[model samples]
Target chain A: MTAAALEAARVWLVVALTLLGLFFSFVSMVGVLRLPDLYSRAHTASQADTLGAGFGLAAVALTVGLAGAGFKSVLLLFFIFVTNPTAAHAIARAAFEEGIVPWTNGDERR
Target chain B: MADADPPPGDGASADGPVDSAETSGPSAEASDADATSGPTTSGPTTSGPTTSGPTATAGAIIVPVEPTSTLRSTIAHVAEAAANDGAPALHLVEIASWRDGDPESDERAAAAERVLERVAAWATADLDDSEAPAAADVEVVTAVIGADDYLFGADDYVRVLAEYAEENAADRVVLDPEYTPVGNTTLLQPLEFALSNTSLSVETAPVDRPTRRERFRTEATTGRFVALFGLSLAFYLLLGDPTYWFDAVTGVATAAVVSITLSRVSLDSTPAIPRTPMRIARGLVYVPVLLYEILKANLVVARVILDPRLPIEPTLNRMRVIVGSGLPLMTLANSITLTPGTLTVRARDSDLYVHSLVPWAREGLFDGSLERWTRFVYYGRRSARLPTPRERDDVAILQGDDATEELPIAAADGGAVGAGDESDGGDETDAAESIDDEVTDR
Candidate 1:
């Protein structure tokens, strides 16, 4: 509650958030790199990456409060949350419409 | 939980939203064990009823609404956004929030219904591509969600919207969040909460509120322009110039001109800006939680990727959407996709078609805790999570399926099975054997 402690808490929180965001970003990289199909990779890229970017921005917001830079960061987060999965959905739906059959175990197509 | 976990759903046991009529029981009857083991064979025969059944969101894309300045943008965005392939029909929804016991509420409902019809027509006219859902079938289906539909009270207005979206089998929920009922934030709170809480993707219609430069002298916009002018003058004086006063005047003038030019056009197009301090603060809170989920999800994915054995058992999870709003639905879908070893293959009304890498991952999808968190964060409420999945025999490629690698044995067996077409049997057997060999070797 004191100024010193509050500042310290804020600093620590920012670090934690940034680190967590980076870790998720790395995980999303692995997901995109490792997952089997287009759909799976999309999940990693859209969800994981959005989270990573969101965290990083949140940390930035905390550090800056209502400054010009902080406001912009929140705006960026909103865009990612809105558009990331949406673009992925569009791609997937397009693929589905094009008759690119989903990959399944064994003789699913049969 | 796999609500309405049908006895068997698709060729894959774990598939999209389960329509009880589509559960193919007799198709996996290659043997009783095959039927039981290959629980999701999707076949009543090779071509199953499930595959042929009408998809939940195949026909319509739903948007819920209220009267607001953002109405135009909602129409434009929803028309364009839900334009998923196949160009589904549009269902415009407006929930009547009146507590049903009073007769006055019914009069209000009737008036609201008339307004809804006009809104629907106006939105349809705005659509440049009526064929977005399909050519020659462009119809605007409008509905009024009422409180009395639920066994609960009017507070369940959110639930009613969700139920309507599901019942109509509409693909998405698009709405403007500007509905603060007659400026009473409390009444609007539940609706916003419900929109976020619903499992369906909820997209808040973006409103083009003028930015700082555009808003003239609003507090949110004032800081930036002032800082520019202030900094310019401060820099002039700090340089220790003897003619500091003259330099300061020039700096002030320059800053004023720059601010005027920049503020004129405004950033109306930049994804909805948070004007209220409260909104910015809430966003700050929400982003961190999203990041935590991302971090946890990444760790999961990392484990899946690093494992030497490459432990992955792919299955589809057919999810019954609890939330009807597009933003929450999408967030949940993106989360699932982001999580290690799971991907959303298809999205439809009331069902999210996810393909998870392992059985564990598939189970995680059904756990419902994720959906609960989403609702809590977005809407400030927690509903019952996923339904418990039915007990199923774990499905995998059987040793018999693999035994096709013994080419000659399979061919001989195929010849006996398909007695008339000797060559067709031989070719089919050869293809199966080759596929088996390739899989076994991999």
Candidate 2:
């Protein structure tokens, strides 16, 4: 393929990845609002955030090329992947101990 | 008044209603159902063997008690057998003749032995039918001795038993009520006290199982795998923004450096404390409320400044805070300080001194929106008992002696007020005015 075509393809890939990232991020926010219990909400938020962040970073990397910006983006993605879930897990564990009950339809325990 | 009953075996159910040995069958089922449904009731009737046969009869075969050392292993075997029969285990520690030698040495050893045996037996029994039941275990420890040797009071024995039950997660203790009246009275009272005080699932003779809720609450949550996967995904999404990620990382690194430098400069450096889950929970609740309060305060402060009449009633007031942690208290103080017309001058345990632009703010000091907001934010639910204004005595104002107070008068020379001077009251009003001015300035 020509250099122009290659550049165009990379742009398209970035666009696609960006859209995927947006989709996951929206889903994560929805999960936070929708899930009944702190534990379940935490589960949804953590998973969606990680996947969305990963895809978003990949898109940025593709758009910027394999240089300074791209490397930094990848590093951010790695940190988020490791720390976000860890923080979520800690919060969930604490909530569980504090006796936060999971939401169930028709249950008014909360 | 009745003849003392024999010690029930591990097979006996302790939770059922007390009935004559003749009516044991029906009462046993009734008691079991009762225990399964609600809190188990403990009474003298539930303390003895349910059967009136040779096993229940007084002076019936009292097995030669083994040495205290071998008691735990023996109880383990008995518990094993009892579990096989779907029964709660029984552990008997006879503290009859504990003070045989010199009052000090012999009695202490005997007391120690009694405590150890009860503890071991209780632990072994709890392990027997646990969810992941340890190897079926029973412990029957009998400390046979003359009447005078029972040196330690029953209360001490109960205390030891309770500690053991908590440590070993034992459900119940079975004591033989066949001893002398004094011994029986002392033992029963303390046993009841221990059973009530500790978190153990206790049952007296005959042995019975605990309720289903007790069992369910103790079980670990089942969906950890799904939770782990979901969390992983969220992390990946957050990392997508390279700029934000780098900024946060750099921020954290800078914070660490600052912390280290501060530590080196002074022996009592501010530590870099991670936000605890409880604090985060409180923050989630408080941030929104704080924003609303700030908005309200800003509006009030603006009205006071803009109106030529300057309907301001500046006053210093102290408020009491009920939260326990330093971080939450700091958050509360900072939040108050951040809002217009209110500045936190001092904060001590359960008390805060605030300087308000309006005197009405004092009315709300302990009874107003901020106090209510603090309580709701700190404790997810409201309690009937709210802290009183008297509690405010503890908090004091650091500033607001009229020396630090600055009015909104512009300098007579027409020069702009210094930033330091403006900050007292003029700066905050100016900031608010500028934001509003920008909307108008636009």
* Candidate No. with top DockQ: 1
Point to the candidate with the largest TM-score.
1
Instruction: Put down candidate 2 lDDT per residue, B1-442, tens digits, no spaces.
Output: 1223232343335453333342333333432331332222211112123232222111111111223233333443344333333332243434332324322335545554544444343433333222212122222233333334223334434445554444433454533322121221234555555456555433333322231223221221222222333333344434344357765565555545544443323221112123234435765676667657644544444444444554443444445565423333544555555554554443433445455544444334534455555545544444214554433332222123322233212221334533222133324333323323333210
- Model 1 ranges off by over 4 Å: A1-27, A51-71, A105-110, B1-289, B325-342, B373-442
lDDT of all predictions, in order shown? 0.51, 0.42
- TM-scores of the candidates are 0.39, 0.27
lDDT of model 1 at position B223: 57
Query: Model 1, B1-442: lDDT tens per residue?
Result: 1122222211223243323332234323322321132222211112122223322244456666665555655665655444333334667766654435432456657756655655554444333222222222334566666645312222355566667767766545665655533222324555555567567665566656331122213543465555455555564454435265786677677668766665423322112233234334644666666557655655565666567665554544455545433455666777665554556655543346566655556555655556655544443422323243221111112122222112121322223322112122224334334544443312
lDDT of 2 by residue, A9-79 (tens): 89999999988778666655654564445543544454354557768889988888766578778778656
DockQ of each: 0.16, 0.02
Cand 1, B chain, TM: 0.32
Q: Model 1 has how many clashing residue pairs?
A: 28
